[model samples]
Target: DAGITQSPRHKVTETGTPVTLRCHQTENHRYMYWYRQDPGHGLRLIHYSYGVKDTDKGEVSDGYSVSRSKTEDFLLTLESATSSQTSVYFCAITWDRGTGELFFGEGSRLTVL
Candidate 1:
């Protein structure tokens, strides 16, 4: 099984504050992604990295940024948190893009007051 971990599984912050969530993986997978789940909007991709120092923005990438300094770790940061950004974030990994299977971390819940 793929080994995935996320830091600060639960977080609460005031509006306009900055927040960062970290995701670490031991699987050495080539592709890692960050997503947020919410009602009605479903799951939306925030960012993803294909290799070390290689990253790309996704659909809802406006307030989110990602960094992949190494193959085993990916970080997602919210430059300035907002109420609308409150949601459960997830980290996922996949070795084969065509496989349609992704290994996901437990989740990180963020609340902006």
Candidate 2:
């Protein structure tokens, strides 16, 4: 509640266009993640960074990519947006690794037509 923000909260794009969503956090947490929430699949991770410059692909990373150049910012880019990629994106940060509980940003809604 104190340290999270997402950009482009709502967007509509054409298929094959490039799009990028930004997540900003002031918590200075070590773990940050990008996830997509769909009707049936629920929340699935697209990518995550444990620390600055340390990133890894997640379960749904096929159509997405991410980068973390600084401690406070993480970016998710859809190189080529597709209709199937339409969904709500969420960013989360964790202060402790053991609990696995994350504080989430409101969300970024993207619709690909």
Candidate 3:
């Protein structure tokens, strides 16, 4: 990964609150994704963007949304944070879809009470 960063590496919020996590990349990768990691769930995709303003829902898209208006940044937002959504969220980037190679940012840990 040439450059990838996740903001607010850690956060704590009350239930029903709104939260947004940011993932930014410097290499202008064409594919970016948001995934949540939890016990026994491994990594479940929440959303992905193929290019600027082009996004699609993923396996676990409920209560989550994503946007990528610029090639360098991807945003993952929870309309209303809930206890069930508490998990470590990760941002990943890939050069292309066929290569199956993905580079991930450090991660963002969210705690919902």
Candidate 4:
């Protein structure tokens, strides 16, 4: 079975509205990350947390934020939605500091109009 799951699975929102997406993990891992996958660009990290309340921005951090108040839950927020944010968002977890491979969730598809 997979280790991660993302909520909403799909969503549609108008421009300038705030949105939040949730990610849950049962793998008991130490690292959780939020990323967006777009055509041609592959996967780009939005944010990541190594421990509760310990988070950091990623490559595409603008207009996005994240929180991890517990071991199994991580949340991503979009301050104000825009058409550029319309993409498939994925949550990933890594087992340990050794192997770098990531286990991904089903994904949340958000469309901003």
Candidate 5:
């Protein structure tokens, strides 16, 4: 275990609402990532951070945003909730970006109705 934690393991909200999720780690890894798991898309990256205040958008980052103010904390926010955005989100950490050995936290499931 890399001391990763995700808040609000499960959540339900109405469409058009705003939702935020938090991911915290104690490992001090250099890279942190947010991903959404869907049936057909598998695990799609939403955002990632390589260092404090250094972040970037990923393949499926249209309605999502991420912030990394510290090396151990990464936050993900959904600007406006949508039924299509309902999915299980996962937070992952990796020390070596080239090796791609990611340690994942328990997923956070979000539902929009």
Candidate 6:
């Protein structure tokens, strides 16, 4: 977890509320990714944005959306929070995929009742 910071380190919410997690990186890595860590899934990609205003959905994209208006900022929003979505989320940034070095932010832990 270097050069990246995620806000709201911990959160507790109801079943239908909206949730947004912010990731800020100082390294200016063009490739930014959002991932969630679960009990058995390890780390799964939720969404990733490679450049400003350009994004792509990942395997577990349902009920999730992302926006990247600036190089240093990435936002992940859950349209409607659900209990199944409760997990620790991480934001990763890498200078290049070839580098094979990705830096992640301190995870954001979310719990939905």
The candidate 5 region of ten consecutive residues with least summed lDDT is: 94-103
> Model 3, which residues run further than 4 Å from truth?
none
Q: What lDDT would each prediction earn against the true structure? A: 0.92, 0.93, 0.92, 0.92, 0.93, 0.92
Tens-digit lDDT track of model 3 for 1-113 = 54889998999999999999999998878899999999998999999999999999999999998888899999999999999999999999887645867788999999999
Q: Count clashes in each candidate, considering only residues at least 3 apart in sequence or on different chains.
A: 0, 0, 0, 0, 0, 0
Q: What's the TM-score of every candidate structure?
A: 0.94, 0.95, 0.96, 0.95, 0.95, 0.94
Query: Poorest 10 consecutive residues of model 4 by lDDT?
Result: 94-103
lDDT of 2 by residue, 1-113 (tens): 74889999999999999999999998788899999999989899999999899999999899888999999999999999999999999999988545888889999999999
Regions of model 1 farther than 4 Å from truth: none
**Lowest summed-lDDT stretch of 10 residues in model 3?**
94-103
**lDDT for each residue of candidate 5 in 7-80, tens digit (9 for 90 to 100):** 99999999999999999998788899999999988999999998999999999999999998888899999989
Summarize candidate 6's per-residue lDDT along 52-106 as a digit string, tens digits. Answer: 9999999899999999999999999998999999999999987765575767899
What digit string (tens of lDDT, one per residue) describes model 4 on residues 38-88? 999999999999988999999999999998988899999999999999999
Model 1 earns a TM-score of 0.94
Error of 4 at 84 (Å): 0.5
In the predicted model 2, the residue pairs found to clash are none
**lDDT accuracy of residue 17 in candidate 6:** 96
**Whole-model alpha-carbon lDDT for candidate 2:** 0.93
